[model samples]
Target: MTRQNVSIVLIVVLGALLLAVPALAAALGNPALVGLATRVLIYAIAAASLNLVLGYGGMVSFGHAAFLGVGGYVVGILFHHFRFSEPLFGVIAGSDQLLVVLPAAVLITGILAAGIGALALRTSGVQFIMITLAFAQMLYFFFIALKTYGGDDGLVIRRRSALFDLDMRDDRTFFYVVLGFAVTFFAIYATVIRSRFGLLLGAIRQNESRVAAVGIAPYRYKLAAFVISGMGAGLAGALLANYQRFVSPDMLHWTKSGELMMMVILGGAGTLFGPLFGAAALISLETYLTQWTERWMLILGPVLILIVLFMRGGIAGLIDQLLRRLK
Candidate 1:
């Protein structure tokens, strides 16, 4: 089969498997399987968001997890006030409805991203990374200081966000709901990559001076992409908070940001579907390894190192190579 045909077959097979997950888990009597799959979808969305700036825009943000934390906290804090029938800041009312909550998370993160990008984008290379990381650390500590919202112990959401008639409490239902969002995001990202803006972003990554010489300011485009990427991370954060029913300062930590970066790099930084593959591979590896040994990170470290050392473009690249060889 040709490459296109092979890719198509692979996608269809992958989709089929995803659709069968809940049934398979039920048959195997392992409901945690659904949860694992749900987590992967959430991470995939977050990792894809990071790819927009990291992969296409050639930006390295060490503090991307701040967006995730912010998004989750938005949901958590809003609901906490709602449960008490108290308005947040004695102004905005808390909402349990998914429609209200998710959009709020996205909008808040977008604003945060815009402010951060406006300043961070002024520098280049390591300075930019450090500035982003600093912003993340600041947010992380800020959350930790919010003693009213469980502080270091974190906050538990008693219930999931309501979405009209949908029963999100059901594992299968929530998984499908998350799947719908993941698929929607993947479609949107794909569309973005095909648009003119995506083309310019790629050009900036390849050659910034040349693009600027042509009278296009790379800053505006980069900032725009950064804001959009943050919004995507925010959306994923909201979904993740809904799935886990908890939010904590750790969500905004540097380590969590590192994890998201690893997902993007491991899956093939610049490729579509790379983040999904990366999230699945990393999460699956962690899941299986932890089941076997407590020191899973020791094993994971070397494995990731080997892949980074030998694999040219990560898992997606490896697959492309195999397909070409088969052809």
Candidate 2:
């Protein structure tokens, strides 16, 4: 078979396995495996969103985790208000509907992304990175001081946001919901990467001056990509909050941003499906390593360095090379 055919087949097999996770876990009599799968899927979505900017647009944002926290807080805050029958900001009422909550999270995060991107885009290289980091940290501290939502103690969600007759309380069901989002995001990524805007973003990444020479304003396109990326992360965060039933400032921490970046790089930065594979591999590795020792990062740190040095394209790139050799 051709390389394209092989790739298609591999993706099909992977999707099949993901879809059958609940049943496979049940047959193996290890239900917790589903939860692990769910975590991988959620992070996959977040990491993929980051890849759009970091991998494709060449924008290394250190504050991507801020959207994750924003999404989670939106869900938690709304739930808190819904329970108390109080209006948020004395105007907007709270909602427990996933339909309502998820969109609100996405909208708010997109707006935040646009505002931040406007300023961050004015700088490049390390300046851009530090500015993003600073903005994220500022938001982090703001959340820490917001006592109404448990502040640094975090907010506990007593119930998952309700869907139309869907029993999200069931681990398997929730896993499937998250899986659906992952799949949908992959589809969107596939479409976007082939679209005109995607082409422009790629050109901008290669040479912003060239794109500008072609009469396309790089800032607007970059800002749009940033907003879309943040929205995707927001959706993932909303699902994460529901999955864990908690939200805290830690979700927005720089470490969380680093993990998402790691996932993208480890999986193959520019590849469409790399984030999913990266998240799976990293999470699985972390799980096994932590089981053996609490200082797993000491081992992980070196391993990642080696990958950066040798396997510059990451695990996805490595697999592609092997496939080419076989062909």
Best by the lDDT measure = 1
Off by over 4 Å in 1: none
Task: List, residue by residue over 240-274, the lDDT tens digit for candidate 2.
Answer: 99999999999999999999999999999978889
Taking every candidate in turn, the Cα RMSD to the unseen true structure, in Å, is: 1.1, 0.9
What local lDDT score does residue 314 receive in model 2, on the 0 to 100 scale? 87
Per-residue alpha-carbon lDDT of candidate 1 for residues 1-327, written as tens digits (9 for 90 to 100) = 777788889989988999999999999999999999999999999999999999988999998999999999999999999999999889999999999999999999999999999999999799999999999999999999999999998899999999889999998999999988888898899999889999999999999999999999999999999999999999999999999999999999999999999999899998888899999999999999999999999988887789778886878898988888887
Q: Which stretches of candidate 2 lie above 4 Å from their native place?
A: none
Each candidate's lDDT (Cα)? 0.94, 0.93
For candidate 2, give the lDDT of residue 130: 97
Between which residue pairs do clashes occur in model 2? none
